[model samples]
Target: MNSVQEGRVALVTGAGSGIGAAVARKLAAQGAQVVRADITATDGGVVVDVADPRQVDELVAGLGRLDVVVHAAGVDDPRAKQRIADALEAGRPPEVTASLDAEAWRRVMSVNLDGTFHVLRAAVRAMVPRRAGTIVVVGSSSAFDAPAGYPHYAASKAGVHALAQAVAKEVIPFGVRINVVAPGPTDTGMAARTPAVLRQAFAGLPYATPEQIADVAVFLAGEESANVAGAVVLANGGRFTV
Candidate 1:
């Protein structure tokens, strides 16, 4: 409940559930004028599909001005952990490319990679004019150490991290900072889709809750990390070091 972000206009994408929802709530609780954006409407946010450039543009326009942008919208297509396990059991490689359907790959890419880009582009377009803003991209540990059977998701998140670094450099002179927060296997709907056996196998390792990731995002958006830029902070409970 810090008042540091009070009166700032913050926009969070994919805010209907999971990490996105948590980030949105965290920002709002800190007194920021939060504009929760997602494709599906919820009690605290508006519906917005970040993959759609036009929608992103319209959202920024509706906000008039934005000081913080948090991109968290993502999708896991054909979420069937059993199918993944079955494929592996049948000697098929445990890789997304080994068995991921064409539509599934496309869906994941569109939502996670393209969606992040669209939101970032829109945020930059608006923030550059103001010459002051911050952006926090919600990446995943998979970007650094991808597990088997989820190449699409991993690759897309890797793109997100790269984009954040590039944008951080490009916008630094504009008084805007951009960074990423990569969370490990988090306890969210996305993680719940994994097979029970696989989940159990990874149970010993620490899994972060959505709130912990959200707190990191808040730090990135606030002024405390003023000198930080082009950085990817890992909130994975020691799962990956970078």
Candidate 2:
């Protein structure tokens, strides 16, 4: 892909670590003026929680002119998986769904699904007036293949894909291009915490580096994806068939 021109304003959420950080640095290297954000990031970006619609709105408003938006902020707390694993270890009947905590379920849905909605909502509003923009939502393979213990995570991701698809249709006609990058189990800290039994579902699949996914995000965020909208591009190493 050609180098993204300098001075292009870009905002990347969850930029404190993982794929979000990688994408922020990548866009910077490509000469775009990036606004890196997270709950806590040392890169001078103000703390912003994607789950809060007000925070998302204010962040976009501060940018003024948004050329690109990459929403990577989402939660994958390990405690729920650990709890299910513990229950199985303690000889309790493996009630996979019952083992998940109600609070955790709500929290995951809020941050993963609702959070994506808030970011996209704000981004669409910002991009619509300009009549040109690119949005790459970092989703997950969990939407298609739910693991044994992470029902909430899986469900939330599914919702993200649906929301992105729906929003893309509404905004594409207005020159706002929105797409999703649903990566498989990449070599992220969250993947490391998955229990063996649950992770077995993704066995034989090679993990991808955060930077690799960042590369894909950079592609979708640039003019290269001009004709692409409401698309879900998988960056997995041949793990999923579709």
Question: Among these predicted structures, which one has the highest TM-score?
Answer: 1
Best by lDDT: 2
Cα error of candidate 1 at position 94, Å? 2.0
lDDT of each: 0.86, 0.86
lDDT of 2: 0.86
- Report the lDDT tens digits of candidate 2 across residue range 14-119: 9988899999999999999889889875567879988889998998998889999999988886787776677667867445676566888889998999999999
- The list of candidate 2 runs beyond 4 A from truth reads 84-94, 196-203
CA lDDT, candidate 1, residue 62: 84
Evaluate residue 150 in candidate 2 and report its C-alpha lDDT on the 0 to 100 scale: 70
> What lDDT does model 1 reach?
0.86
In the order shown, the candidates' Cα RMSDs to the true structure are: 2.0, 2.3
